[model samples]
Target: MSTSTSTAAADRTLVTALRERLQLDTGEAVSLVETHISWVLLTSRLAYKLKKPVYLGFVDFSTLAARKHFCEEEVRLNRRLAPSLYIGVVAVCGSAQAPHLGEGDPIEFAVCMRRFSEDALLQRLVPAGRLELDRLEQFAHRLASFHGRAQIAAPESEFATPDQVGRPVVDALARLRVDAGARPTRDLQTWIFEQRKALRTAWFARQRSGAVRECHGDLHLANVVLIDDQLTAFDCIEFDPALRWIDVMSDVAFLTMDLEAHGRRDLAFRFLDAYLQHSGDYAGMQVLRFYEVYRALVRALVGRFRVRAGAAQPGGPDYLACATRLARMPNSAPRLMLTHGLSGSGKSTMAAALLAVAGAIRIRSDVERKRLFGLEPHERSIDHPTNIYSREATERTFARLAECARTALQAGYPVIVDAAFLRRDERLLFRALAAQLHVPFSILRCRAGEADLRRRIVAREAQGRDPSEATLDVLERQLATQEPLDPGECAAVLDVATDAPVDVDALGARWLALSLPPITRRPAGWSAS
Candidate 1:
């Protein structure tokens, strides 16, 4: 018999015996799903994942010892996100001809996990219209928290720089062209290389500035599920450290690329906004599009691999189209909008809403102030006198905000300066900056009743880890000294009442539907209602 035939027969025998030997009370039989590198046996409420003896440039599992070690690693890493889902690993003993569970010497290793209904997967739910906005926001916050806690990749690590990080993308594109003869991937491939040329410098700077970290490497819809009413991510890359240790934006780009591939670009925007809010990592946007292109092409190449292996993957072409769309994305000219309000007047909330709908990058006082102090966004109350909101410190904070806004605006991205722009000079500084950049400018005056604002100040301070350090005294002082907009600013001002729900998407759609040139395309999920 041929070698391929012999291997297939051996695999079938091993799978059948595994189903019989593994203890499960599935009334009838267990179903097995085979992927390129692993076989997953599904029981009533359990899953057994056995790695194939596959060798690839990224990973090697050809040896029995290698499989065993990776099985243990999978359990250790995935438990961080899905502790309850990943149970433990087990040894398959006896023989491949008639294998018995844990009887003789170890032959194969399997990672056992608690399996739940597949319908709850975010991949499935998004297409079916069951994944709501609130749930997506929740998932974003959870992922942001995960990134915050993840260990930053050391500078000395081999995969700690952009050239090293993009090696896989380069390799994947080469494979796609070689396997998919005359597939017309040159245009898409050309655009990807162009973006590489544009973002190569920023990519390295981001890694040097600590944006690189150990992240959930394979964060796609299929690996994420809504378990027990919570969105849970599992099955991270375990065999390859190069894939797992990456710039955080590269990790976020994978899911967004997946969503766009499914014809759901609207959710992709929402997810990105939510994650940016929670993580306060706006600087990483420098390389976001670069990674998005890379990630989309990776999926496209994988689809081709499946097709060449005689597997049915009809969505492969759609993935390639997504890659081209991402690469050819038009650069929207920068625009500036500053928030006008006291500390607790809902400026941040309005800013977040505007960002979600308008596709604007936000620069916040609370975040940048801390950044000026070399502190994390949530780290507060250090260097009491110098960090205690002195006049000099406040000026320095706004200066840093302007610097950041300048960089983002010059890069052709719309910006939202999310600060308590109570001082006339501070507000005027950004307005002048917008004029200098020759972009449309607007001021969002976020107003709320004093009673509500005062209450909110107390509540916000009570919530520990809040970036804002505003107190009752601060609120009262702000109310006393707040300046009104000048008559010259009237034509470009927007008054926003923060007392109720504000669907900024719909509002933005209506406001920019005519007369105004939109900074970004309106979301398909929203209308001019």
Candidate 2:
């Protein structure tokens, strides 16, 4: 037999031996789960994953030593995120006929892990409508924080190079050409070529600026589970550093694409906005669509492989449709909207609610102001309290917000500035920016009764959970100096009664209707491939 066939046969023999004789607390027969790259034997509480001795070009676990090294690597790397899930690397010893685990000279190796309930996976939760927005927001916060602290790729490394980034796309496209229709594959390749050129400078700049990092290579919903009501990410790509060390936005796009594939575009946008809010990576949005399409194609290729292996999968066509949909520009043109409100008038809340429907990014003055002083969203600025809220600091904060809004708008994304645009000049600054960019501009005038605003601010302060550091004193200052909209400005305003229930969807639709359509560069008659 050929070497690969022989290796496969040996791996099967070892797996079969382990399944029959492995001991567990449940006293039940050990069940096996097989993927293209590994074999996992499951007990009641633990899972032992053994790598298949196969070389897939991108990854190689074809030798005993390679498998052992990768097994240890898996444990080491995964512990960075989910330490409790990965117990350790354990040895599988003896011949295939009488395999032993963790007890003899190592003939094989397995990464032992604590098994979680399959039902708690985001994959199932999404379909069952059990996934809550709060949980997703928390996950976004954790992931953004993780990405911020992840190891930056070495300057000398090939990771995130233009060639390296495009290699996987080319490989997946080649496979898809054979499995999918020739015409669509060709069109997709053409679109990718154009997009790559458009985003070339951005890719290199991001790489140099440390946007590339060692990330969870496999961040799909399937690899994420809810343990003790926390979103836990596991099963990262340990076999290939090239895959694991990538642009952080590439990692973000995987879960974003998966969410869209599962028909939750609203949640996908919500997740992306939350991630952006935490990471302050607005520039990443420029290349986000490219990565989203690339991720979809990769998943499509995997689904095709799974179908060939006789496994039930979402099937390649579903992902292909998603990619095609993503490649098309947004239905409406990108516009800029400023939330006009005082402290506790619900500008932040209103901005968040309108994000999904408007397909926009929301930048908050409170968060960015704290960020300027190297503080987290909810962190106190006790050390520099006066400086943080000074008139000069306020000017800097509004300037920063304006810059962020410009970046998102230029990247063909609508933007909502969640700030107290109580000054006519502050509002005019963003309006001029929108005019300069030739995108539409409008205002969301959020209002609440004075008593209600004071009550809400007091309650928020007592809770100490919100990002705003605005106190009653701050509210009084805002009320004293706030500028009401002039007649001309009022003409462009979408009044939002914050104390009452607002139909964000209806409001978003009306706002978008007034904006100019986005400049889609394609010919007028062209259709989405």
Candidate 3:
């Protein structure tokens, strides 16, 4: 037999022996799972992942020392996010006929970890229709918090440089050509070059501003799981620092692209909007589309690999189509929408619904107001006390909202200012912004009765989870002084009744018709409503 075949045979024998002889915490039989690069031994309570003695261009585990180093690296890096899941590195010793998990002279290494239910994976949850928006929103907050504190790449590092950012995308395209036996379409090629050229400055700015970090390079839904009802991210790319050290937006794009691929665009936008709210990284949205296309192509290549292994049928072509669709940009320019309503009238809720179908980014006043004061979204204004809602503070908040709205609009994304636009000047500020940017603008006029508004305010206060600190007193004051849209402003208003159940799909459709310019063409499977 050839050397490769002989080595594979030996590796298989060793895996079988280890599975039979290891005395795991669970007394049940051990099951073995194989992948292109590794083998995992699953016991009831634990998992032992061993790298295959093989060399792929992107990774090398052919030598025992190399495997040992990567095993340790995996445990260390994955522990950054899923500390409880990774249990540290262990040795595989003894002869292949009598292998031991942690004994004798070490022949190999395995990263030991706590086993999680496969069903809890987001990959499974998406297809099963078990994924909920609330859980996804919570996960968004968790991921944003993690990203905020993740280690930033040094300026001297080779990561997130313009060259490095484009390398993987170029490589993914080359691999797709080879694997699919086809070149990318002319449109995709043109888009790739144009987007790369456009984002060069943004990439440099982001790198200087510490947007590049040691991130979870492989952040697809399959790598995320629900542990104890918490969305936990694990299995980060540890074999290659070049891949792991990337722009934070690239990391966000991976999960968002995967969510879109799973036909959950609404959830994708919800998660993204939530992350932006927490991280205040609206500036990163500029490069998001480029990274999204790259991520989709990477996934398409991965799908091809799985298909070659007879693991999936539609895996490759399906993702290829997704990449093509993602590459297709809207011919029309982006729009700006403002929410006009009192607190408890569901302005935020309507904004979220609009984003789901409109493909927009939402910038909320309450969130930005707290952020300006160095407070988290749900944090009380007790520290700022008297000045948290002062007229000056409100002015600052509106200015911040306009700033974020401009950023989003400039990034080629629709913008929704999800604030209680209770004043004419407040409304005019956004209108002027849209006019200055030369984008379409409209208002979602949210309405709720006084009784319903009072009840909602009380309930939201009791929950203590909303960013708004609006009390019944605040509502009463707003009711007394809030300005209604005049005749000219009424031309651009889309009325929404907040007291009754909202047909979100219908509202989204109406809002799009009233706000954005008509799309000349949509990608296959792309929907506006």
Error of 1 at 290 (Å): 0.6
Scored against the true structure, residue 317 in model 2 reaches a CA lDDT of: 37
lDDT of 1 by residue, 1-529 (tens): 9986787678778878888765444565688889878999988888999998878867898788999999999999998888999999988888887775565698888999998888998878987899988888788888988998989988777664756756666776787678764253677777666666777788778877788888899998888998878899999999989889888988899998898788776678779877876676777777777677788777777777667788854543367677777666433446778888887789887777666566567888887787676666667766545654888989998888887788777765678888888888787777667666666777788888888898898888788657888888888888799887777666677778887777787755533332333553222232221
Off by over 4 Å in 1: 23-28, 132-135, 148-154, 160-162, 174-178, 181-187, 263-266, 307-317, 329-331, 343-345, 370-387, 448-475, 499-503, 510-529
Q: Could you tell me how far off, in angstroms, the CA of residue 1 lies in candidate 3 after the best superposition?
A: 4.5
Model 1 clashing residue pairs (backbone): none
Better of 1 and 2 by TM-score: 2
Q: Which pairs clash in model 2?
A: 333-518
- The pairs that clash in candidate 3 are none
Candidate 2, lDDT over the whole model: 0.85
Ranked by lDDT, the better of candidates 1 and 2 is 2
Candidate 2 lDDT at 333 equals 74
Q: Clashes per prediction?
A: 0, 1, 0
Candidate 3, residues 450-514: lDDT per residue as tens digits? Answer: 88899999999999999999999999899899998877568778889998888888877766665
Question: Which structure is stronger by lDDT: 1 or 3?
Answer: 3
After superposition of all CA atoms, the RMSD between model 2 and the true structure is 4.9
lDDT of 2 by residue, 61-104 (tens): 87889999999999989998898899999998888878887687
Model 2 ranges off by over 4 Å: 1-4, 23-26, 180-187, 314-317, 516-529
